[model samples]
Target: MQFDKPATTNPIDQLKVVGKPIHRLDGELKTTGRAMYAYEWHDKDVSYVYGYPIGAAIAKGKVKSIDASAAKKAPGVLTVVTTLDVGDLKKGKFNTAKLFGGSEIQHYHQAVAVVVAKTFEQARSAAALIKVDYEEQPGIFDLQAAMASAEKPDDSQEPDTAVGDFEAAFEAAPVTLSETYSTPDQSHSMMEPNASIAAWDGDALTVWTSSQMIDWWRTDLATTLGIDKEKIHLMSPFIGGGFGGKLFLRSDAVLAAFAAKAVGRPVKVALPRPFIANNTTHRPATIQRIRIGAERDGKITAIAHESWSGDLPGGGPETAVNQTRLLYAGANRMTAMRLATLDLPEGNAMRAPGEAPGLMALEIAIDEMAVKVGMDPIQFRIVNDTQVDPEKPERPFSHRDLIGCLERGSKAFGWDRRGAPGTRREGQWLVGMGVGAALRNNLVMPSGARVKLDKEGVVTVETDMTDIGTGSYTIIAQTAAEMLGVGIDKVAVQLGDSRFPVSAGSGGQFGANSATSGVYAACVKLREAVACKLGFDSEDVVFENGQVRSGNRSVPLAQAAADEGLVGEDTIKWGDLTKTHQQSTFGAHFVEVGVDVSTGETRIRRMLAVCAAGRILNPITARSQVIGAMTMGAGGALSEELAIDTRRGFFVNHDLAGYEVPVHADIPHQEVIFMDETDPMSSPMKAKGIGELGLCGVSAAIANAIYNATGIRVRHYPITLDKLIGELPDVA
Candidate 1:
């Protein structure tokens, strides 16, 4: 099924099950601890060993030598495999740094060896026995020092774009504001660390891993291992969380597979908590400069955004200027990104990626510009709203309700009651409210699925789409149920198995719409097969209440199936619809904060997000994603930062205890409101992704709220108390 144009009335439009707030079917298994993770998978026929990885101590240079004799003779140690032993291994296409073999120490904590043993303790103990010497080399660790040498990233997804003469427009504008903002390197901090369990039978290998994109990992693993893709099978039915950390193949799976092949048994590997930050990908730190010029009447005339971040040689820029190019209407607009070579960990996607950090700076700049022009921030945004892309006016949005989101969110947040900064006092606390616009691109990918219809009128959907704790299983079941006209309980969902059809694989907020649309396509084929089996016209047949009906004739849906269940398979291929339409999700985030006058500490009083994404599939799960993202955004504004070890070139605070995320006590009330909307251009489900949309601009709302409460503008992220203390009035 090619979704080339806008969809008409489809089975999903019936809304019998797709839009309902249904409980997650895997809720019980997860809460009860019955769902097995990668390292916990048990197979009675196989004997499992433990593998502990040894990472490079230095950030850059070559390995001089490794003395592994002590580790080979250690008790319970099976074998030790080093990068030198494995020789050169090909890097995956999506990877900027090598995972395992032939490591020249591209970054800190690059795995150089793995020790396999009978137990985890033995493997760890054996790993400690192996010693290596490295020839250290000076590497660039500071973004500021390398900024002069930074060049425009040639491999960037979207290169620099310019519309009109931004310089002239900005110089001529009466009202203008210019500011610089900084965002620090941040970790995913997902509950489950990178883990994998690999087993081999004959020449074929199977790996159970904690991964977000199963097929991507499968393809990359084969490439990295130099083996046939058909010889490998990957599965990850459940994941604690990814946040984009587990989106690609990491060292844990590769080392585990290598150890399993060497030991002639299954091997499990899990990265210790401390290694997660430096060993895997992180959200890169960014330095952004934003200049906005507007009319005295609050219409934006010119906007320019430039951002620079450091990464490995082959890595791309952070793309912190993306939202600036499309978020508002401006005739003279420009956006550019540069990348510097740094010896830190590889930078990759996290949550909303570009938009998340981009908005942290862009939205705050918008708020500051609003104050300069003497206009309400909400009104300023509304006045500059554009239905078409600012850079490409010919490509209009499928549907945009940013104004609706802002107006609705402002009313609910009591924006009219907001007072001057540092004027609103509630006893010892200073109160204020702030708003920021949310924007994330709507992405669609080719996805496929297989559906089976049983003789007992049951439906089962199989796809490689992963849950990543985002409710993929529940939503897919809902889609199959809606299409087959069966109760959601009667539909079974099997996911994350390589044997199943390939799906969008859960990243960049495209999983829900793309994966469910794949199931919808499979169900369409099944409906046709059922109509033919029942001797009825496929176009006019109706599937309802587990019955197939055509005109006055009706029959049980199960009667159309043979003794064996009927299977249907199809892929949802996208054409030029996305190119023809500028598809994006929009929302507004509102935050009210209270600042302790004496301590300069900021606390969130309440939070609300108004979303105008296409039809929401499951409100319950979608709300969970929003509130969770809001909490993460709060952390980015108040606490989260990956401190750099300038001397050693690594993350200083690499563990969870040193890094601070919002706990339950730190978060107050949070409310999510989704506008009633549907976009035929999105898919047959008429739904766009809400996961990353919930996180897009939330951090800026907090920053804006803090500024409103204290009258202090903080350009740096994680607005610590020190940044506010000097500006606050003396307190008793």
Candidate 2:
């Protein structure tokens, strides 16, 4: 089923089960702790040993030598395999830095060796006995110091959008504002760390690992091991959380496979907490400069956004200027990004990636520009909203309602009650409210699935789609139920297996829509198959109450498959629909904060997010996603930052104890409202992603609220109390 043009009326429009608020089908397994993670896979026929990995000490250099004789003699030590023993190997196409093999140390915490033992404690204790010597070399660690050497990245996703003369338009405007802002590099810090279990059956490898993309990891793992892709199997049944951290192949799987082959036994490896920061990818720090020119009437005439970020040699830029090219109405607009070479751990996607950090700066600048023009922030944003692409006017947004989001959010949050900066007083605390617009691109990938109908009138859907706390299992069941005219109880969903048909995999806010669309395509095929077997025309064959009806004739759906079950397999292919339409999701964030006048400490009082992202598949799961993103936004605004060691070229705070995230006690009253809308251009399901959209610009709303409470402006991210302490008024 190729989705080239806009979708028309389909079976999903029935509003039977797809759009209802259904509880997650996997909730029982999670609540009862019956779901098995990567390291907990049990097999009675085979016993699993433990492999503990040792990471590289030096950031940039070559391994001089390794003395593992002491580790070999340690208790219960089966084998110790070093990188030098493995020799040179191929790097995966998606990876910027090599995972393992050879003597080169590309970054800190690069796996150098793994110690296999009879028990986890034995392997851990034996790994400490091994000694490694490295030749050190200087590497770039600071983004500001390396900005001069940064060069333009070859970006095919979105090249710099330039129109009309930005300089002339800016110079001629009556009210203009220019400011620079910075956001720090941050960690994913997912609930479950990277872990993998590998067992080889005569060169046929099977790995139970925590991976988001099954095919990508299988292909890459085969590349790293110099084996055929068909010989390796990978699956991740349940994941605690990923946030783009486990989207690719990690060292834990490779180390486990190598150790299992060496010892001729299955081995399980789990990366220690200290390695999660220094050994994996992170959201790179960015320095952005934004210039906006507007008239006294609050119409934007010119807008330019430029950003710079540092990463390993072949890594791409942070793409922090993505939302700037299309967020508001700016005639003469320009957006550019530069990538710098740094020797730090590879910088890649975390949370929302580009739009999350970009909005953190752009939205705050919008608020500041609103003040310069003497208008309310929400009104200023509403007046500048654009229904079409600001850069390319020929293409219009498929569905957009940013104005509605702001207007509705304001009425619910009592925006009119918001007063001037530092004027609203509550005992020793000052209170204020702020608003910001949210946007993230709508991405679609080709996905495939297989649907099976059993003799008992049960439908089963098979796909590699993963549920990384985004409710893939629930929405998938709902899609199949709607398509086959059956209740969700009759649909069984099996996911995260290599043998299953390939899916979009969870990332970039594209997984839910793309994966379910694949299921919908397969179910459509099954409907046709059922109609044919029952000697009925395909058109207007209404299936309901476990019966297939055509004209005055009706047959039990199970009777169509009296003995053998029917199967339908298909993949959803996409054409140039995205190119013809400017597809994106929009929302608004309203935040209220109270700051202690004397201590400069901030407390979040209330939060609300109004979203307009097409159809909501299941309101119960969608709300879970939005609230989780809102909590992450609170962390990004207040306390999340990866403490860097410049001289050492690694994350200094390598463990969760030092890395801070939001706790339940830290958050306050929160609410979310989804606009009653759907985009026919998105998919047959008519739904777009809302998880990432829930996060974009939320931090800026918090920062703006802090400024409203205390007249201190913070241009850098993680707006700590120290940035406001000296600026506090004498008596407030």
Candidate 2, run of 10 with poorest lDDT: 152-161
TM-score of each: 0.99, 0.99
lDDT, candidate 1, at 41: 94
Evaluate all candidate structures by whole-model CA lDDT and list the values in order: 0.92, 0.92
Name model 1 segments beyond 4 Å from true: 730-732
Question: Model 1: how far is 418 from its true place, Å?
Answer: 1.1
Give the lowest summed-lDDT range of ten residues in model 1.
723-732
Candidate 1 TM-score, C-alpha based: 0.99
C-alpha-based local distance difference test score of model 2 = 0.92
After TM-score superposition, what is the CA distance of residue 455 in candidate 2 from its true location, in Å? Answer: 0.5
**Residue-wise C-alpha lDDT for candidate 2, range 583-662, written one tens digit per residue:** 99999999999999888898999999999999999998999999899899999999999988999899988787898889
